[model samples]
Target: MCGTELTIEQSGIPEAIPVEFCYAGWQESLQLLALLTEPEIPDQA
Candidate 1:
């Protein structure tokens, strides 16, 4: 199993919110791995 944490801010809000996400099972693990390993493209502006 794998887990991730995130903090998000809402418009007009003074504080950030904490969020947690977890992935389990074989399929979910694969998906999580793909997301973590995906390549990022550079901006060519």
Candidate 2:
């Protein structure tokens, strides 16, 4: 099995939250990689 991880901390957050974004296939994996880079995608609500 394959595994990966991405850790990040928000502006006011103290500890780095571990985001276990698992991917099923290569196409999905690529998408995850892209997301991992941009850790600052502010929510638009």
lDDT of each candidate versus the true structure? 0.54, 0.55
Per-residue CA lDDT of candidate 2, range 22-41, in tens? 22344486687878865686
Record all residue pairs in model 2 with backbone atoms less than 3 Å apart, i.e. clashing. Answer: none
Q: What stretches of model 1 exceed 4 Å from their correct place?
A: 1-24, 42-45
Q: Each model's TM-score?
A: 0.34, 0.30
Model 1, span 1-45: residue lDDT tens: 665555534344233532232223444766787788877889999
Q: After superposition, how far is residue 27 of candidate 2 from its true place, in Å?
A: 0.4
Clashes of each: 0, 0
Q: All predictions: root-mean-square deviation over Cα? A: 13.6, 15.0
The true-versus-predicted C-alpha distance at residue 21 of model 2, in Å, is 18
**Residue 24's lDDT in candidate 2:** 36
